[model samples]
Target: MGIRHSSAGKMIWLLALASLIHVSSLEAATAETVKQKPPRLNIVFIFVDDQGYYDLGCYGATEVETPRIDTLAQNGVRFTDYYAAAPICSPSRTGLLTGCYPRRTGNEVWVHRPDSGTGIPPSQTTLAELFKSEGYATACIGKWHLGFSEPYLPANQGFDHYFGILHNLDSYEVAHFEDQGGVPLLRNGEVVDRNVDPGKLIKLYTEEAIGWIEERVASRHETGSSEPFFLYLPHTMLHEPLGVSPKFDGSSNWGLYGDVIQELDFYTGRLVDALERLGIADETLVMYVSDNGRGPGRNQQQPIRGSKLTTFEGGLRVPCIAYGPGIREGHESTVVAHAMDWYPTLASLAGISIPKELVLDGRDLSALLLGETDTIPEFNQKVSLNAEVPLRREFHQDLEWERIFTRQEYLNAFFYHGSHGALAAVRSGKWKLALNPSLTLYDLEKDPGESHPLNSWEIKTKLRGMAIRFQREMIEQGNSN
Candidate 1:
């Protein structure tokens, strides 16, 4: 009996040892898998209106100070050759949000007047909506210049909460606009707060944005879920009729424009501080870009020859920076990226798939931001076309613009606008060609400031042919739509 009991004990010990070894192997495998997972990234997009490329310190501006925006570029990636989809405000915003070309939505024209047609078609899907569907809590603060009426507001789109002006604020003073005051201070679509001070607008928006961060964090903790949050904060201070808070009224030596830019910098610092305080700074992605180029028109020191209406480089080239957890730091990408690229970039970062049916002109720049690509891929670039195809029958009833544009004289007059129109540029690597209406070819790589026009007609003819082809492609896309 004692021998039988000894055999049974030996068998039990052997089985127990095998079980322990299997459990250890499983735990080790689980840990290895966990280590290989990609980190989640949260996004905080800061968009400023009418901010020039030289407005920020990182962009080579020594005259004015922009410490916070400068730090963002210093800590992450600065896009030196960034372009807006349009020289004006609304179309640019449309392109940024939709990830599609402005002309695709038939809104290349300006939308300054209150009674202007719908900015971006309501039928289009927005970036926020895509992110929200991916479990991100989205909010848009400061400026929503895409549309001006019913079914076009932020909440109507995909934003969970929105606080700021629906249209672009032309004047900085609160007293300038009468319809801005009183109730929900406009909640979900209803007027919420009556009588808001323009001087206090930035502060109010900041506090509200902070509240959103805190609320999302608390909600996530309570639900035991890990989800990212998106904050689209577009400031209106740096634009025309610049206004600064009382604290920064006399802070700069560069006049009102300088003061307003400084104030915007301060606001940026405040938002960064808020994110840090909430302990979500490292998890969040912050992208700062201007809505368009300078708005105060031309000056002796800063000659903005066309102001907001022109398509000059001064009107299209704007400051852009991206800082986040996964993006490389202290690098400058001369890749010619446009504002339209933001929507697709953000969607890609969140691991959300863009709808296949909806055509997106922009490319996902994840590889570019991660330092995986030394040169921009040809498949990921954009081509511009300067063509005039009249849409409304009434608008083209008087003359056939098609015949005129096909002729060489029309091209000459177009480039003679002196406002930067009648030109189409296609950039890949260091080679860039600007096809002007004068049948002139400009190599932007050697002459970035566009000081000298090229003397080669062959190259110009090739560029013209390319531009014409691009226009035809656009028309084909439009017809398909």
Candidate 2:
């Protein structure tokens, strides 16, 4: 009987040992999986309204003190030849968000009133939508001029939170010809104030942005979530009818405009400080840019001809600063980049897959921004035209138009000017062909001011032909829509 009891005890001990081994293996596997996951990346996009190409200190403004914006450029990469998608407001924003040319959405003209029926279509995918799909919290905290209707607001357009005016802050004044009375200030689709104070708008925006970041961080900590976030802060300071808070009043050498700019710089510094204090500076990507060129008589645009209304370098070119992880410090890139490129670049950085069916006019700039390669693949290669047939009219709603350039006609660098539905000019590398009543070609490299007109029969003929073809294609695409 004693021998039988001892054997039963030995069998029980063996079963316990096997169970311990199985539990230990399971814990080890979990640890390894956690370590293999990539860290989440955050994005902060700061867009200034009607800021000039040389408005900030780093970009070369002596009167306007912009230390914060200058520091951002010093710490990150600056683009000397960056261009906005359009020369105006609404169209520029549309192109930036959709990653397509403004003409593709039939929004080439500037949108002024809130009652305007035109806006970004619901069928299109926005940058916020792409980021939100990957579990990022998205927010827009300034100047939302895309649309004013419930269906067109930022909340319906993939942003988790929206706060600011539905259109320009100056829309509240009665002097403007297109004034829609007082603009509605909103928070999450609800009207908080009808007539917002322009003097306090910049300060208020900065404070709200800081608060949003803190709240998001605390919530993530409590929930133990590794999800990232996207913040779009579009300031309305430098536009017409500018005003600065009492603290910044008469603080700059350039009067109220300069004072407003200085205030903008300070508040921007506050945001950067917040990021550092919250311990997310290393993981966040901050981009500072302007919607278009500055307002006339309000800012300087030396060496670049024309202003906000024309199809010239001054009208399209704007300051661009990129700072954060994975970006080379204090670098300048002359590779022509547009506002539309941010869509694909940000998505590529976050490891999100773009849909195969979606057509993108912009190329992924991850390689160029990361210093992995100086050359962008296919940047200079001509696009093939015969590979795909023309898109049918039914697909027009989807913006399924033919490629902009054919392989034989493609230039190393090209920019089309579609201001107010008219193709005014075409810039192919250093040559610019303007078709305002007559065809005039100029070499921008030699005459940055565009004072001298060149009479090159060969270059003019080639660019003129390309322009005519482009116009014809645009007309055909419009008819299809």
Candidate 3:
């Protein structure tokens, strides 16, 4: 009996010892996994000024050479149904930066001058502010048209580094430069170059951007940190008073405009190459988009129908591309995406949150970017304060500004306002109803160009009601603001 009990006790001891050894191994493995886990994503947003939807090779520009930009589409996702917040600059930038309808923020109707007192309100939080909250280095290296003044400047708007012009090159009081300060180029609130040359901006921006990135990386290494970065490279070229590098002068079949595009493509390639050289390419995500579509005559195919500042499809829809880590490669998503979406999408990726009181107009697109889902989910806007999903798709505040926009009209709808803030059109799914100029209902799925209008009264009436209600809500928001 004693011998049997001794054997049993020995067996139990061996089993417990084996269990403890397994547990210790697991704990060690867990620690290693946690230690070697990748850092948060580094984001580089490349926004160009006054680019056309069909201006890039990826978007079907045969006259201009955009091979480098096309490479992004070949390697990543290109958005066909992407629309800018507005058909113009200041309003578009406001929507993209604030993630709220421009009208909601009260800047959709005007562009900021060099000496303008009114700019992006200081109360509104920007994407830079959001990224900064999560310990990411933020820099704005290019045209910053939000506001040229103190509070509206990039520095006070949450950017750690700012190297760009406060307003557009054309905003200068004089048309020509006389070697004196015409348009100032600022670096961290100091005027580094007076009488800035428009032709040289692309190169300077690229260099400054890459240099800033390198400095940030070096700082991280010196401090033994793994912090990520957010770089907003809003290029200053391609707008009015267009200029290109002498090397790229007359390089394309299309004239100076094409040369400007080629230069843009070249500099964009440089930025991408820098990311790869830094070994952060695979861990970084890059977005290339335009602030708004080009003005009349850039693409007659576009302007003949509707150009920038108009409520037509050509004016509102623009090209967008998402590349690098966490984004599906070589895919063109037809989902309706917008400029404001980036605000929430980036925040979600960084595991951060925006202010609760702020009404967010963008939907979280991280799931789509990560290859988890294709369709953007829908939710009720009323429960926005604590909702798990996005309230709706989007509302075009500048397609045509109506006096009022009722928020509770439709969960999934888009409103179009004109440059002057008139509510001109409303869209639901594939059906688009144009109010101003004419009450024409066009099936966008079938007639993407708005070439043909269907006499479907039912569809038109439904969309009209949606628009009227949306306009009512806009009035409410406007008054409250």
**TM, every model:** 0.79, 0.82, 0.85
Off by over 4 Å in 3: 1-36, 171-180, 295-304, 379-389, 392-411, 479-481
The alpha-carbon lDDT assigned to residue 16 of candidate 1 equals 27
TM-score of 2: 0.82
Writing each residue's lDDT as its tens digit, candidate 2 over 1-481 gives 0101123332332232222222333245555443444346688999888888877888878888887888888867898878888887788888888776677676777664566776888878888988998899999999888876776789878899888876775534323323434666778977777666788889888898999999999988999988789999988767777989999999988888889989999988888889878767766778999988863323334577668866777788889988776666678877767887787677765656566555555666665666645644343211111111111111222122234334334323345555575677776667888878788888877776677899997778667666665556567766755
Taking all chains together, the TM-score of candidate 3 against the true structure is: 0.85
lDDT of 1 by residue, 9-40 (tens): 32332232222222333245554443433325
lDDT over C-alpha atoms for residue 49 of model 3: 88
Task: Go through the candidates in order and give each one's C-alpha lDDT.
Answer: 0.63, 0.71, 0.74
Candidate 3 achieves a global lDDT of: 0.74
Give lDDT for model 2: 0.71
- Residues forming the 10-long window of minimal summed lDDT in candidate 3: 1-10
Error of 2 at 94 (Å): 0.4
